[model samples]
Target: MNRALFQKIIFAWFEKHGRVLPWRVKNHEDAQRMSGVRETLATYFTKAWRRDPYRVIVSELMLQQTQVDRVLPKFEHFIKRWPTVLDLSRAKLSEVMIEWQGLGYNRRARFLHEMAKRVVEKYNGVFPQTETELRTLPGIGEYTARAVLAFAYGQDIGVIDTNIKRIFARVELGVEANAIPISPKEFQSFIDFSVPKHHGDPWNQALMDFGALVCTAKSPKCDHCPAKTLCIAQRIAEEYRVKTYAEFLKTPHRNQQKKQSIPFEQTNRYFRGRIVDKLRESPIHMEELRMHMETNHGLSSRKKFGEIIESLVLDKLIYIRGSRASLD
Candidate 1:
């Protein structure tokens, strides 16, 4: 359960049964030829293949309020479209929203676009190298900034996402297997002392993947867990496997809860569609577009339509045309 034993177990298990992901590998032709990978996934198990700072920033932004699997396709689509920070900075806000479709919680798209603008204007379209500088960007939180600094730029700092938080919480605190309450300060402490000095990036990845695959939320495979003995939850399991804090707590269920479904033919949908349709055609005056949305789309109020329009604007699916509106 000591640090040395914990590190030994986890590192050994990592060498044996680690998952292979595309982003983990270096794909450059020279790197590939030297690394003996099939031109696509050299260094597939290490941190020598993380994306650049800009891509890391984009991926982190997209990942907020969204799952990794869901973010992957959208990430690919976004990379194809923008390809670079300057490209994104110049892209129409509305077009970015359209590209961001299906990622729900549309506000993130707004932050991303704004962040890109700031990057272009201030950082000369290059991501900041230090965590402090990176965190100064729009919508870049501490965790995200640290992640970019560590994973992308290879800075030696601890980065804690949900997965790493869970692993450390259980391993250190004897909390429930899947229900650990993680705090930023405590997680930072773990990161400061847990990860090996030279291999901070891979060690972080190992923790993330270990939490995801071995120490999963619902049911953990403790028998094969690398840090099992170090894990407080496993110690609890050793004494009483199926009994923990989360198990005994009981709560009421508000069953049969349902949303008052908005009708498809409602003005909201119509106005939204019309806004998109018009934007597609060309930019229009904001006042004139508002009138169309209110009258033709049966909108209840200008304010309501305006809010929707604003949301669309933030999503970057539409553009403002000479103080008016346009589709991107």
Candidate 2:
């Protein structure tokens, strides 16, 4: 597809079908400036939306390995509670962890808290606009660093997450994403070249919304996809619509094992989360925790459960003093 035409189609679809997310909301100035642009609706809508860097970091950390629907409420509550980086920096780790209930990933809360403190102390509560500076912060990885640059500062860069990689694999590489693994970094150069500097903000948002709502990872709505005409993997995706998850895994192109593993309830991560959930209510004795684990997670014996507790303490997620353990 022609790069300009691809952008045109995608940008138009975005104006029509873009998601209404709280974190994506534009500030008063952006809204006012956007409202005054009389060149063309496409020109107006194509511009990147400006956002508070604080909200962007909060939403980005909360959305990791979690669904949008799940993050929506939690993000709102968290922002209301600690409206800025300075506020979050002042909060205790234990208080942050407690507010992180139902978010599953306790470590994310810690990272967010630590990142806020660094931003407050080092940068004086202002997020650096450059990717190099942002990466030094806790929990700020490659994708996150660039995402902050693009979404928060409207930098002329693409934010390549899994959804964008899937879109690239099918639309540009002529293969279903499930047929092989897709790495966001592999296509970073292509996306950066393709991304229009003026519309970098809405452009990345459009691609993400397109992937989530239309060209999804499973059972993609190819027939209804606005980019189907340009997508090379449309027919390939349609061909596999009848296959079950097991069948997809068993296929030679899948590059995955078909055998099942232990249930999530039996995993150490699940038990760790269980222990965290218990600690959230209040501090408890080690024996009581053992009994709680036995009653809830079906662990009747220690079986390295003690090791998990010590590990959590070592990770700074919890603190241990004598027989009692609690969130650090």
Candidate 3:
């Protein structure tokens, strides 16, 4: 496939259909007036945009394994309260946890708190420019570090998230998401090769939107997909014992049932979250806390109950005295 042509197709679609997420505040409405050119992400956004690296990190941390709809209100309220790394650094862990009620992955909240503190204390509230330095912060991983670089700093790096992975597996590798042939390291390298210079921000964002809207997990809109012409999966349909797109979609990912999501209400995760949530109100007697978990949440084993409390203590989300447990 021609790299230049691939980029042209992807970008043309994005000029028409890219999302205006809260995290990426580029002026989509201004594209047409400006001859359909998307704005590049700078060190800080335009004054009208108000997107600093601080907003980028906060939104990124909150968005880990969490959806946009859930994170939007929380993200807004969060930055509104603590608009800068300096402000977040001063907040108590308990206060941050309280503000992080609805988002289930509680450790991410703690990590965000620690990350803010580190940024303020070590770097004087300035985000590091390099990926090596950024990864030193708590909870900032491979994908996140590059995301900050591309979306916030406009660096030319690939972010191989699940959406991008799915797109690549289909369009590049002619495989389904569940059956990629290479290891993560190799797949990342393949993704790295796809990023175009000077426009990696829009390019990566375009792939993400294309995957989410067109090249989706189960029901990809192959007929309407702009890259359907170049999608290796479609081009090689006959090789998979299929000749039509409809049959090709069924043949490749036939067993690709979405993993059944366990209800958050029925796990230790639920109790762990509830323990923090209950503690946010006030301290409670140890016995009363046990009773609440067992009675309300159907906690069966006393040993499991003790483990939950002990784990929360280990995680420093709570502290226990003689007969009471409270938020740390």
Candidate 4:
């Protein structure tokens, strides 16, 4: 494949359609003019926006296992409340968890808090620039480390998120979707090779935007895709559509059923969220907790509730004091 040509096509599409997210840095000169600041474009983009590692850290952590749409408001609120690593490090974990409500996966909130403390205490409030140094922090994995390097440090590194992985699987390997347990090392090599030199940040961002808006997991917009002619998955999907249509003509009544989702109210996660939400307001007795659960959520299993409370306490998410339960 002509990698340069591919990069050109992707970048051209991105220039027209790249997402305007709050975390993304805007045009430096325009922003400076608007703000009436007398700083150079280099200083504004490098120092004020892209180079601010704190913003990258917070956004990347929140984006993990969460959708961008759901994260937008929470991210804005979080950054507004705790604008710096020192602010976050000094905050109570319970307060962090309270702000982290509705974003589920409460463990991430704790991890972010711990990461902030580590950055403040060990690094003296300076965010690490290298991937190796970043990996030493709590919950900093390979993907996140590389992301910080590319986005914040302007390093020519490969960032292999789920979307980028899927794009590679389809465009390079001719697969409809990436299979489970993809080999990270092999895929990383492909991405590192394909990423244009000196254009790592925009290249990675464009690929991500294309994957999210055009080449989605469930239903890709193949007709509107810029790389349709070059994409093997598009051809494969076309063939599959024709075959499926023929089969449907033969057996129109045998349509496949959609999978059913488990009820949220019946889930342990739901109850855990309820427990945390309740405690966010005030500490309550176990009896009162049970009553609220029963009355509000229609959950009547006292034994199950007790088990969940015990589990939360063990996880250090909650504290129990003389039959009263509160956030840890």
Which candidate should be chosen as best, given lDDT against the real structure? 3
Model 2 agreement with the true structure over 136-174: per-residue lDDT tens digits: 999899888888888878887878888887888778755
> Candidate 4 versus the native: TM-score?
0.66
Compose the digit string of candidate 1's lDDT tens values, residues 1-328: 3777877777677666666543443322333344544422224444363556767777778877888789878886787678678889999999999999999877888888988999999989778887788778888888888888777766666787877777776777655424333334434654556767666667777777787788777666776665655777566544543443233122111011112223455634456677898777777888878777667777767677766676566556787767688766
Error of 2 at 222 (Å): 0.9
| Candidate 3 to truth, TM | 0.67
For TM-score, the strongest prediction is 3
Residue 19 accuracy (lDDT) in model 2: 81
lDDT of 2 at 194: 74
Tell me the lDDT of model 4 at 188: 66
Residue 154 alpha-carbon offset, candidate 4, angstroms: 1.0
Candidate 1 pairs with clashing backbones: 93-316, 94-316, 94-317, 94-318, 97-315, 97-316, 279-327
Lowest lDDT 10-residue stretch of candidate 4: 252-261
lDDT of 3 by residue, 1-328 (tens): 5678889998888767777665665322332233344444332123343236677787888887788899998986886688678889999999999999998899999999999999999999889989899999998997888888887777777888788999888887676777765556546656776889766677788898888888887778887877877878787665555554446667533333223223557555677788788889999998888888888878767887886686567556799988999986
- Weakest lDDT window of 10 consecutive positions for candidate 1: 249-258
Cand. 2 TM to true fold: 0.66
